[model samples]
Target: MVGVMRSCLRSLLKLMNSIIGMVGTGMILYSLWMIRLWHQHLDGGGSISQIPWFIYTFLGLGISLCLITCSGHIAAETANGHCLSCYMVFVFLVVLLEAAVTADVFLNRNWEEDFPEDPTGRFEEFKKFVRSNFEMCKWIGSLIVAAQALSILLAMILRALGPDRGGYYDSDDDYTPARLPLLKPPVQQPPYAVDSHFKLKNDVWNTNR
Candidate 1:
């Protein structure tokens, strides 16, 4: 029953990681598509410098997220302490960043002033979208934050559980005999040593004669 629960938790973690991977892949592909469109618009008349820096930021973020999710997958599969610890650290940092951004958005009235103006206008569009569907966005944002928290919790539980039983030994085999040390043969004593008293009496008699 415990094993079943652990397996379920591992599967859930993998599913979460897959979801994160898809999100990262989508971001990367979108950023690349935007870059391609921008290049076409330039038509050999403009340099790459004309491209918005936020696009590159998204690309970087996407790559980082993909790498982190890959680590998460490995951690879930192997249940290694080190891998899980590293995954948790990276995920915790990402969660922390998201939390900070959310806090700023809620607490600061001049938050928009802190961000650079988007040359692509996508940022403005995103803000408009969020405003239009604030409740949906709020629920989505909350779910994402909750998923990250749950992933961290699951990873901690897995790390505490250590590696799987199947990894070390077979369940059906009784390995006690195999693990036992080989027995050494008993030592044989020389005949003279066994009859030491007789030899000593003979020596005494010889000395007396």
Candidate 2:
């Protein structure tokens, strides 16, 4: 029963990591697309000299998340606790960082109003550009943040309450006897000790190991 539970737990963890991987990859691809869109906006005489910091932030976050999730997935497959410990620490830090960034994107007024007004209806074009590029990223970033938080929670639970058994489970067939070296007298040493000086004098039995 314990083994069955452990198997289920591992499967669940893998599923969660797979979700993380997918989301992270999606964010990365979207960021790249948004970057291209921003470049186009720049070429069209848009006065937003700076792209939103959140674009680069999302890229960094997505890469880190994908790598960390992959590492955690592989580590969870092992019985070693150290890997899980390290992974948990990373997950905790990332969760904090992601939450903070997500909050900043909304709460900070500077980002939304950074662009300058153009007199020849360019402002309207830029507004559409911002809405299209920023809105998708904003929503996706929010989702990714929530998903990362969820990942952290699930990872913590898995780390704390692992397999139903205390440790790894193994069958009787997996057990093997330990091999110990057997000590024997050196082959070159004769069974009886001989006195070289007095050729006839010799010990009854040799004691050298």
Candidate 3:
């Protein structure tokens, strides 16, 4: 039953990792598309250094996500304690970052002041998009956060119940008591044998005397 549960959790973690990889890939593609559009719009009017900073930011984020996704998948497949631990730490950091950003957005009235101005106005457009699709975005974000949280939990549990050195789950029953060694009976001899031998010797000695 424990093994089955571990297998299910591993499968779920792998699926979440796949989703994370897909999100990373999508971000990378979107950043590239944006760059292409920026190039076309500029038409050599601006130098390469003038490329928007958000593109690079998204690109970096996507690459980091891809790395984390790969780590998570490896951890899930191997079921190693160390791998699962590190994977959980990485995932926790990501969750913490997202939560911090979300809290800042909700609690800080002047959160926009923390960020530099974007000349391309893509940031404002992104905010508008979120506002327009608030319900969809909210559900999606909640699902993503839930998935990450669940993944971390599963990783921690699997780490606690990790495979042995041979890469196999130890099937020994923890509740069963160990068998004790059996006791052996002592060998027995006739009680009259020694007395009979002594009597025969005494009779012989008396006759000799």
Query: What C-alpha lDDT values do all the predictions have?
Result: 0.84, 0.66, 0.81
Which regions in candidate 3 have their CA more than 4 angstroms from the true location?
44-51, 164-209
How close to the true structure is residue 110 of candidate 1, measured as C-alpha lDDT? 100
Candidate that scores best on lDDT: 1
Number of the candidate with higher lDDT, 1 or 3: 1
Clashes of each: 0, 0, 0
- TM-score attained by model 1: 0.78
**Clashing residue pairs in candidate 2, if any?**
none
Candidate 2 weakest lDDT stretch, 10 residues: 200-209
In model 1, which range of ten residues has the least summed lDDT? 177-186
Of models 2 and 3, which has the larger TM-score? Answer: 3
lDDT of 3: 0.81
Runs of candidate 2 exceeding 4 Å displacement: 38-52, 102-150, 160-170, 173-209
Tens digit per residue, CA lDDT, model 3, 128-199: 999999999999888778878888888888888775343343545532344322344456676755678888
